[model samples]
Target: MAGRKRNSAEDIVRKLRRADELTAAGKTQEEIAGELEVSAATLYNWRRQYDGMDTDAAKELKELREQNGKLKRLLADAELEKDALREGSEGKILSPADKRRAVDMLVTTMRVSKRLACRAVGLARSTYARTPIAQTPADPDAALRTILRDYARTHPLHGFRRAWAHLRHDQAIAVNKKKVHRLWKEEGLQVRIYHPRKRGGVSSCPQTEADAPNVVWAMDFQFDSTVDGKAVKIASMIDEHTRLSLMNIVERSIPAQRLVEEIGKTFALWGGPPLVLRMDNGPEFISSALQQFCANRVGISYIAPGTPWNNGHIESFNNRLRKECLNRNHWTSLLEARVVIEDFKDDHNHRHRHSSLGYLTPAEYAAPCTHTHQPVDGREID
Candidate 1:
C-alpha cells in the first residue's frame, strides 16, 4: 500500500555519520550502502562530503544537549528536595505518589524523557524505570493476562507449570510452557522464589564453625552508578561470626588488586586476616592477585557458582543496602555515594537488629560485655 518510508533529514545526517564510521572500519561501500538503505554512490558522496569534517561533532553536540537537559533536571530535583525537607521539618510528610503523579503529568504534557521527569520531581530513576501494569487496548495479551491472573487468584499454590496445564485442559487451548511461564512472570503471578540447593554433595556442605569473631568473613561486591552513569563499585566484607560489617569500599571500578588492597586494610584493622574468607567465584575473587594475596594468610573458600546463599550473610546485607540506601537515594557524585553508603553501613551495624543474633544489633552482639549486650533489666530496646 505504501512505499518504504523515505529517509528523513535527521536520518540522512545520521546515516552519513554511520557511513563514515563503516568506511573507517574497512567495510565495503556496497555493505554500507545496503545497511543504510542508500546507493553505494550516495555513500561515496557522503564520505567525500563528511570525511574531512568532524562528523562526530554533530553527535557530540546532541549528546551534550542531552547531558545539559539532565543537569537541568538534577537542579530542579535538588530544589524540590530542598522544599520537601523544609516541609518535613514542619512535620509534613512528603507524599511520593503525588510527586510521581506530577512527574507523569510533565512527561505526558511536555513529552519529556522519563529520566528527566523523575529527576525534575526528585523521584528515584529506578521508580520511573519500573514497568507499569495497565489495562489497555494496545496490549495484545491483555485478555490472556487477565485470565491467567484470575486463575492464579483461584489457585494460589499452582506455579506456571500447573497454570499451563490448567489452561490447556480447561480452555481447550494449545500453548507451550515457555510462553505461559514468561507471561506468568511478567504479570507478577509467580509469588514465591524457590532456590535450589544441592542435597547431599560434599561440595554442598555448609560450614559449621563460625563460632567466634575473626573466624570467617564473607565478601561480596555491590554495583551501582552515579546519576551521570559513572560506575560505583562497592566491595563489602562482613564478619560471618559477629555479623560485623568490616569494610565498605566504594570506587569507580574494583579490580582484583583493589579487592586485595581492601582486604589487606581490613586485615590490619581487625588484627589479622580471618581463618576463612567466604566468597562467590567472581572474576576479582578468583583472580591471581587475590589468590596470591590470600596465600598463607587467609583461606579462600569459593561457593558453588549461582548459590549466593552460601555467602548468606553478605547477600542478606546486599538486600538491605540496595533497598534502603542504594535504590531510594540518588548519588550525584562518587563522593556522595561513598559517604552515604558508609553512613548506611554504620546504621546497619549500630541500629539494625539481626534475627541471627537474637534480634540484637551487630554492634551489641559483637560487644564484649554480656550485661550491656543483653537486654537491660529484662527489657529490650525495641
Candidate 2:
C-alpha cells in the first residue's frame, strides 16, 4: 500500500521556486502541475501553503532563492553579451527585421548562424520589421553567364572577386561582391596555381646608376677563338644609363697592362670615366691590379659578389646582342667576331630603335653636348 504524502520544508522550497517560474511565464495551476510532474491537487495545496507564508521570516532560505535568481540573470546577460560580440566581429548588427529573417533562414537552412543569416539578407534586428528584406538573385544563371563571358577571354585566370573588380573598373559592369562570388563559383574560373620564388646566390658587382647617361658603366667579356685554335677575350664596356657601348676591345687575354691601356683609350673617346664600373668576379675583374686600378687610379667603388639583376641595363643589352647578332651567326676567326660585334655596336648606338629610349635610336636618344666632350643624358624610346 502507498504511504500518505507529507509536504516537508525542502518540498515547500522546491515548489515555491517552481511556482515563481511558472507565474513569470503566465502559466496557470494546471500548467504548473503538469510541468512539475505533480497532480493539480498537490500543486494547489503547495501554493496555498507557501504563497501567503512570510518569506522574510525564513531569511536564510530567502537568501538562497535570491542568489539563484541573481545567477540566472547573470547567465542570461553573459549569453546576450556573447551573441553581441560575435555579431560585431562579423560586421553584423541586429535590428527587428534581422531577428525575423534570421529565424526564417534558421528554419530553412538549419545550418548558418542566426546573425549570419540575417546579415546575408541585409536585415537588422531592431528595424527588420520596418524595412523590406533585400531580394535574392532573380536570375543566377544569367549573372554567371555574363560574368564568365566578359572575363574569360583576357582574364581567364581571374577569380570571382577579381573578375568582379575588373568588370566594375574596366568594363563598367556594376555588381555586389556576394553576387560576383556566387557567379565565380558557378563558372568555375579561378587563378592558376604558381610556385613560390626561392632566394638565390648574389652576383659580385652591383649595377648602380644615376638618372643620366655616362654615370654608370658595366664591363663583361666574350670568349672567342683565333684561327690557330688559341682563345681570345673581348672586353666590352657598356654605359648603363645610355645603353651605349663605350668601349669594345677584342684582345688575346685581359692582362692588367692591356686592360689599363684600353681604359685610357675609352676615356679619351667617351670624354670622362663613369662614376662606377660594374664587373664580374672573373680573374680579369677581381685581380689585384684591376682592384688597385679601380680603387686608386680610377677612384671608383666596387660592389661585392654574385648579384647580377642590379645591372639590368647591361644584361638586357647583352641579351639583345646575343639573340639578334651573335646567336644568328658563327665566327670562324676572332677578327670576324670583332668586326661583327663592332658593326652591331655601331648599328645599336646609331640606327636601332630602342624601346627603353622611347623607340629612338641610340644616337637620337643620346643628347649632344654643345660644349667639348661633355656627357649627355640619354632618353628612352617609347
Candidate 3:
C-alpha cells in the first residue's frame, strides 16, 4: 500500500487556493480532491485547519513557529550554563580535579547532560571523561611526609626550609628542598608569614657590623606579666656574629645594679665580654653603674634613642621569643616563666634552625668559630 504525502503550510495553502478556484469553476468536491491527488478526508481536514488563511499568512505562521522553537532551545542552553556557574561558585575551579567535581555535581544534582556540564564548567569533554592515575603502594614521599609531619608538630613556628634543614642535617634524610616545600604545602604545614609595615626615615646612629664571634653583642628588654598581674621583665643578650643567645634574665624588676651584675655574669660564663656592647639608651643601660662596667670591660655602642633597628639582632631574637615561647605559654608564677623561658633559650641555641645561619642552629654555627669560647659550669641562676 502507498502512504499518504504530508504537505507543508505553503503547499497546503496553494492546494486550498486551487481547490477554491476549481469550486468557483463549477467543479465538485470529489473532482477537486481527485485533481489535487489527496483523499477527501485529507482535503477536508486541511481546509478546516487552514480556513480563512492566505498563503502569506501561512508563511508568517511557519516562520513564527520556527523562531519560537529556536528561542526555547537557546533558553534551555542558557539555563544549563547558569546552573553550572552556580555550582562552581563555591571556590575557584582552578584545577582539573576541581572542574571534574563540578561537572559531576551538575550532572548528578541538576540532571544535566555530561556534555553540557563540561561546557558550563569550562572543561573539555575528553578531559572530563579521562580517569586519574592511582598512586602505588610504595610512595617515595611517604617517609619524608612522616618526618615533616613530626617536625611540623614539634616546631609549629618553623617554615618549610627549616623543616628541610632538620631533615637533611638532623634526620640525615637527603631530600631536595623544593620537594620538601611541595610536601609541606600539601600537608598544610606551611606557616603564616608576617609582613611588617614599611616605615620611612633612616636612623642617625651608625650601625656596627659583626665580622666574628664575640665582636659585638646586642642587648634588649621585653616585658610581660604573670597570670596574677605581677610585672615580668626580660633582659635578652645575644652574640651578633654567631646569633647565639648569651643570656635571658627574667625577674619582677631589674634595676641598673642588677642589670650590670647579670651582664658581668654572662661575660664570665661565656669566657669573656664582647669588644663592643650594642644597646639602646634605656635607664638601666645608661646608668652610671652600667656605664662604668662597660667603660672598663667593653665599649658601649648606644643606638639612637628611639631607633631599635640599629640593634636589630637582639630585636629579632626578642620577636622570636615572644612569638614561639612567651606568646604560647601563660605563666602562673615568676618561677614558671623563668623556667619555660630558659628552656626556650636553650632550644633556640641547640635546636632552632636559623635561615641566616644556613639553616644551622646558633650553637652549631658558633662551634666552628675559633674566637668562640667554651662556657664554664655553674651557669644556672636561682
Candidate 4:
C-alpha cells in the first residue's frame, strides 16, 4: 500500500512537470487543459494545481532525495569506521575458534587472553607479553607497624599473604596476586624469623599474691656481654600486682652487695617493702647478702626457689626490653650499651605500655600507692 502511494505521488510530479513545460512553450492554460480534455473551470484548476505543485510533491521529493543521499553517505562513513576499529585490533594470532574460546574464558573467569588482552589494552603484543605490571608500593612504615602489633597480640595469621588478604577484604585494597607478591617481597613483609621453639608446653606463672600492688615483688637479671670479655648483668625488680619495674640497673655483675643496695634504693623510692620477695635460683639471688637483706633487714619472706616463672612481671619486661631495645641495636662498648639500656628502661617505665597493667606505664601503675596484705589467719588488715 505504501509503495502504491509513493508511485501515485511520482506520477503526479511527472504530469505537473509536463504541464509547466507546455505553459513555458507559450501554450495557454486553456489550450494545455483542452489538450488534456478537461472543462474551463478544471483548466483554471489545473493551472492553480500546477502553480501549487512546487509546494508539496516536488518539495517533498527534493527533501527525500537529499535525505537518501545523506543516508548513503552515512552508510559509507559507518563502513569506514568499522574498518578502522578492525585494523586497530588485527595483530592477534588467534584462530576463529581460539578467539571464541578466549572470549568465553574471559567472560567466565573474568580473565582475558594474552594476545586479546594486549589488543584490548592498546599495547603491542610483544610489549604486553614481556612487560611487567607496576607493583603496588606498600608503605614500609605501615607494614612494619602491622608486623610488630600482630606479633605482640599473637595473631595466628601474621604474615604477608594473610596480611594481603586482610588488606584486600578489610581495607578494600584491590591488588592483584603478582603485584602483591612483588611488593611483599620488596617490603620484606614476610615473617623471616620465627619465635624460638620450645619442646614442651609453654610455661605460665600462676598468680599467688595479695591483691595490692606492693604485696609481692619479682626480681630477675638479664646478662649482656661486653667486647672485652667482661659481662654486665641488669638486675630488675617489678611489682607483681601492678607489673611495674621498681628497679632496673646494669652492673658489672650481680653482686650481693649491689643487689642489697638496689633493693634498699627501690624501697626508699617507693615505700612499703614487699611481704614476699620472689627470686629465681640464680647465684646472685641466693647470695648471703641478698638472703640477709630480704630475711632479716627487709623482713620480707622469700618465694620458692627454682621457679623464675613466679617472677612474671620482670620476665615480661625482659621480653619487651629485648624486642624494643637490645634487638634493635648493636653496641660497641659496655658504657655505650649501659647508657642505651638506661634510656630504654626509663622510656619503658615512664612512656611505654604494660598490657597487664591496663596499658598504663610503670609510673602510672605505681601512682595508686597502697598495699593491704591479706592475713592468712582468715582475717583482713584494716
Candidate 5:
C-alpha cells in the first residue's frame, strides 16, 4: 500500500512555482496534476504554500515569473521576423506589395491586430497601404529583366544598344528601345571595358626630391657584349637629386669588391658618402661588403625587385647610355670601351637636358655642390 504523501517546505515552494507556470500556460487542473505528479486537490491546497517559505525565496520566485513572461514575448517576435523577411530577387528590394502581404499573413496566422502586426514587422502603416488600387498593372519590364540577364551572359562585351537591336527586329519582341534602356540601367548591366596593364614593378618606399648633390645616389648595372663575344658589365651611379653620373665603371666581370672600391673612390672625391643609396637587389649592391660600406656612412634603400622604376634616376640614365652609347657602337677592346663610355658620360652631364631638372643639364644642376675648382666638360667635377 502507498504511504500518505508528506509535503515538505521545499516541495511546497516548488509545487507553488509550477502551479503559477501551469496557470499562465492555460493548463487545466487535471493536466497540472499529471505534470506535477500530484492530485488536483494538492495543487489547490498549495496555493498558499509561499507564505511558509523565506522572504528571499519568495522574491526569487516572483522574479522568475516576470522573466518567463518576457521570454514568451521574445519567442513570439522571432517567429514573426522569420515569416516577414524574404531574400531580394534580381537585385530588387522587397516591394511594398510584398511587405503588405507579409503584414496580412502575420495578422491572420498570429491572431494579432493589423496595427500591432505592422509595428512588429518594422513597416510603416502608410507604406503598407500604398498603391491602394487593386487593379494596378504589373511591371512591363518584368520579362525584360530576365531576358537582359540571359543576353548579357551570352554576349558580355555588347552594350545595351546592341541588345536592344537584337530584341526589336531579330527576335520580333516588339519592345520599345526606351524601355530596354531604362531596364538596363535599373538592372546595372553593362559591357566590361578592358584596362591596359601597367609596366614595371611599383615603388614601395616613400620618396622625396634629392635636395642636394650627393645627398642620394642611385646605383645599377648594365650588360653588353664585345664584337669578339666577351661580355661587358658596367656599373653606374647617378646623383638622385641632380641626375649627375657620379661614377661609371666598365669591367668584364663587375664583382662586389670592385663596385665597393668604385663607391669608396666617390666618397673620397665627393667628401663623404651620400645620405641614402638607392639600388636594386642585385648581388653586388646587396652583398655584405656593400652593406658594411654603407653601414655608418649611408643608408641603403633597396627597391622592390622587377620594379626598375623604383630606382628611376639610374634606370633613365642606363636607358640613355644603352641607346646613345652601347647600341650606337661596336666595342673591339675594353680600353676603347672605357674611353668611349667616359666621353659619352661627360657629354651627358654637360649637354643632355634632363626634363625633370627643368631641361637643365645634370652638370649645371650639380654645379652648386662642386665649388672647389673648374669643371672639365662636367666629367671632373667631383
Candidate 6:
C-alpha cells in the first residue's frame, strides 16, 4: 500500500472550509471526509486546528515559522564562529603558519569540519590541506645578520638606509636595500624616534623654492651648553637645493658683525653668493650690520616672526645636527665643542647619505654645481 500524503496549511484550511459548507448542506461527516479525500479522523483534526484560520493567515503563519527556524540556524553558526576564533589566537593572524595553527585549533578543539575551519580562519582550503615543507638547515642570511648587528652597534643613530649603504659601498656587498630593510626589521634594529608636541599655525610669508644648487641658502641658530653650563651657540648655513652644510660655527656668542663675517667666508668658499638668503626674523639677522652686508650683494628673505617652517631647510639640518652630534657628545670647553662640531659638519657633508639626493652625500651632490661657478672675493662688501 502507498504511504499517506501530507497537506499544506493553506490546503488544510481550504478543506476545512469546504467541510463546513458540506455540513451546512446536511452532508454526513463520512461523506465530507470522502469528498475531501481524507479519513474521518484526519478531517476532524484539521477542522479543530484550522477552524477559524483563513488561507492568508495560514500562509503567513507557515512563513513566520520558516523564518524563525532560519534565524535559529544563523545564531548557532555565529556562536560557533565566535568560539572558534576565541580558541585560535588574540590579535591579527599575519603569517600563513599562524593561520594554519588557527585552522587546526578550530578543527580539534571546536570540533568543526575542515572546510568550516578554513573558512572561519580565512585560510584557503587547499593551503590548509597541503603538508608544509621542511625548512632548510643552512641559514642564508647568517653573514648578513652579523654585519648588520655590528653596523647597528657602532652607529646607533643611523637607520636601515645607512646600513644598506654601508653594506653596498663600504663592505662591497651586493645586496638589495629592501632585503636589508627586511633583515633590519627582523633583527629589531630601528632608530628610536622622539615625537614632539605638534604646533598649529600656517606660515604668513610666502615660501621660497630652491630650484638649483646655489639658488637659495638657509641659515639658523642652535644652542647647547658646556659642562660648566656656559652657553655654546651654533650658527649653521646650508644650500637649500643640495642640502650641503656650508658653515657650522660654534661660538660663545655670535654678534651681527661676526655673523656677517662668517657669511662672507662661506660665500668666498662656495664661489659666490646665492640668489636669496633665507632666515628667520632674529635680531642678528635683522640688525643694521647684517642688513648693510646683504643690501646690494645678496637678497634677504626673512621668514615671518615665530614661523620656523618658512625656513625649513635650515631647521631640518639643525635637527640632524642635534641628533647625530650635539646629543651624542659631551663638550668640556669651547675649543672642544668647536672642533667636535666642525668634524661632525664635515662628516655630514662627505659621509651622510641623504635620502632626498638618492643616497648621495651633500658634497657629492654639490660637486657638479661647484664646478660651474666662478670664485668671488670675500672682502667685496658694501
Q: For each candidate in the order shown, give its overall lDDT on alpha carbons.
A: 0.74, 0.63, 0.85, 0.61, 0.74, 0.84
Report the lDDT of model 6 for residue 130.
Answer: 68
User: Which stretches of model 5 miss by more than 4 angstroms?
Assistant: 1-202, 205-208, 369-382
Question: Which candidate's TM-score is highest?
Answer: 3
Cα lDDT tens digits for candidate 1, 1-382? 9786665335557887787788899998899899988788876765554444454554565567679999998887766545444433433324555556666766776666666666556678886555454434677678778889998886564578667766665576787879899788777787764555545434354453466787778889989999998889999989887788999899998888977887898889979887778888899988999988877777778887767767778897897688668977888999999999999899778866565676566788888723212223543211
- TM-scores vs. true structure, each candidate: 0.45, 0.42, 0.73, 0.47, 0.44, 0.62
TM-score of 6: 0.62
Model 3: per-residue Cα lDDT over 321-359, one tens digit each: 998898888899999999999999999899988888888
For model 6, the stretches where C-alpha displacement exceeds 4 angstroms are 1-137, 197-202, 369-382
Query: Given candidate 2, what's the lDDT at residue 122?
Result: 55
Q: In lDDT terms, which candidate is top?
A: 3
TM-score of 3: 0.73
lDDT of 4 by residue, 1-382 (tens): 4342232344545555676788899998778767755456754644554446654765676678779999998786556444433544446644333344343444345343444444443446655343233233554446544543454354332455555554554456666656666555544456555555433432243334647877777777787766676777787777777766678788776678877887888888987587667666777777787777766444343344544444556777787677667766666787888799888778667765545655466677778757576756653221
Q: Which ten residues in a row have the lowest lDDT in candidate 6?
A: 373-382
How many Å off is the CA of 22 in candidate 4? 66
Over all chains combined, what TM-score does candidate 4 have?
0.47
Q: Model 6, range 234-253, lDDT digits (tens) per residue?
A: 99999988988898788999
| Residue-wise C-alpha lDDT for candidate 2, range 62-159, written one tens digit per residue | 56767999999878655654554454344453444435645564436545455544554455645543433233455545755665767665445335
| Model 2 stretches with alpha carbons more than 4 Å out | 1-207, 224-230, 296-303, 368-382
Q: How many steric overlaps are in each model, in order? A: 0, 27, 0, 0, 1, 0
